[model samples]
Target: MTWARIMAPLSGGQGDPPTIAAAVALAEPFGAELACVYTPADVADVMPWMGEGFLGGVQTTALESLKEATAVGEGNARKAAAASGYAKTHFIGLQTPVWAGLSAESRLSDVVVFTSDPARGRGPLAEAFQQMVADEQRPVLVARPGLKVGGVVAVAWDGGKEASRAARLATPILERASRVVILAAPKASSRSFDPNRLKAYYAARGVSADVEVLSDSGDAAPGLLKAAGAAGADILVAGAFGHPRLQEFIFGGTTRTLLGTDGPSLFLSH
Candidate 1:
């Protein structure tokens, strides 16, 4: 089935432009409804950490900041530069915690697209994104603003459940792409990991794909990126490995590594 609904969590900042535009671009092809969720940082939970109280008095508390964020997010998304067409767009301002808001929205969406920050791995925003992915049974696309989503579709296929889920979850995007390439990081040969099987799977679904085996050499991330780049893929879909919290907490694993890459926007599922 195609993606019928897309949820984008906007924090109402410089990152909004690209993130909203990217989500709109992806959703436009399928006429998916784009729900822009405005998330404001909860001041009450964080104000105690402000330490000095110097910039505190003027700083917005939870309720007021959320209203402002929602208003701005709605305005920006309504006039999203690249977002055009008959696809419906709406803004939703949530009062719940970041994790809860993202979680609730995710439940109503086929996929959640949002801007990701690599450097702020341990921050509240980062944790919320990670938690959303981990706690919910939904797909998350970590997108960089301004990056286009089309052309060749790249899938990092290892035949694991997460990878399989990712491939299936990415069906909507894959159907819209011009081509599909299933890139596998080959280690000692294993019967379980067959890129051909994945290609065939896509074929049955009306999406054609080719299989390429890249050397394991050392790390899987580099090989995956190299193959994907060579194939001119504008987007990379991969299975997330490890617990989201542990991975983000230590800033390690394939998910975090790829998130930091300058390659393509990521379509990841846990």
Candidate 2:
């Protein structure tokens, strides 16, 4: 498996620079296209709540404000992309049906890129990040500062469907990794599985990997992070376990812990 395109949704906020830099780093290794999409607030979402009795002038003013914000956001996003100096970058500004356009872009791309702020629900792209990971079920790269793609990669496995899917989708990245390590905590998980099986799976794809069995612990995230840091890993590949809760998605305990830490960039799939 090879990546041909990488999508990064920018909210025209402070996170755009790091997000674009991470996207460019990933794309450079595979000579992939970096699709930087501008996502602005949609005016249509607020129209229904304005009620039928709202004044015409108030509605017009609101619409105008949204339009102005969109224009400014697009300009900021474009500037960020250009500053990356990546030749294969493309900047796209979504129209009225913004969510639909974002969905289409993510569907066609090999993977979506997001910064930690958004993943932690502390940035403008938080909602879009949740939509991509939980709702659209797209492969995502939760990038951190100084992100690198073709470095030591760690995979967290527990013999679950989500873990299997994440490892499979991350094959291209693993293939390019200088070293691959499979971190397993059989005692931490309820499922019984062999880490060697995953190592062998990677061998079939011409990728060599080492297996490290973590000591028994109630929580696995801490162990996984410690091991990955010890190995000087650039990215950790894992399943994003979460479910929708009201307007937000609540991640599993382990996943939430990993997301909260600033250790390594995460390559996750639902």
The model with the greatest lDDT is 2
Candidate 1, residue 10: lDDT: 67
Where does model 1 exceed 4 Å of error?
47-87, 118-124, 188-192, 244-252
Reference-based TM-score of each model: 0.81, 0.97
Question: Residue 127 in model 2: shift from native, Å?
Answer: 0.5
Q: Residues 48-132, candidate 1, lDDT per residue (tens digit)?
A: 6656653545554644665566677656645653354434887776664655766788898998876667223533356556665
Give the range where candidate 1 is weakest over 10 consecutive residues by summed lDDT: 118-127
Q: In model 2, which range of ten residues has the least summed lDDT?
A: 53-62
C-alpha local distance difference test of each model: 0.73, 0.91
lDDT by residue for model 2 over 51-106, one digit each (tens)? 88545878778877878888998899999989999999999999878889999999
Best by TM-score: 2
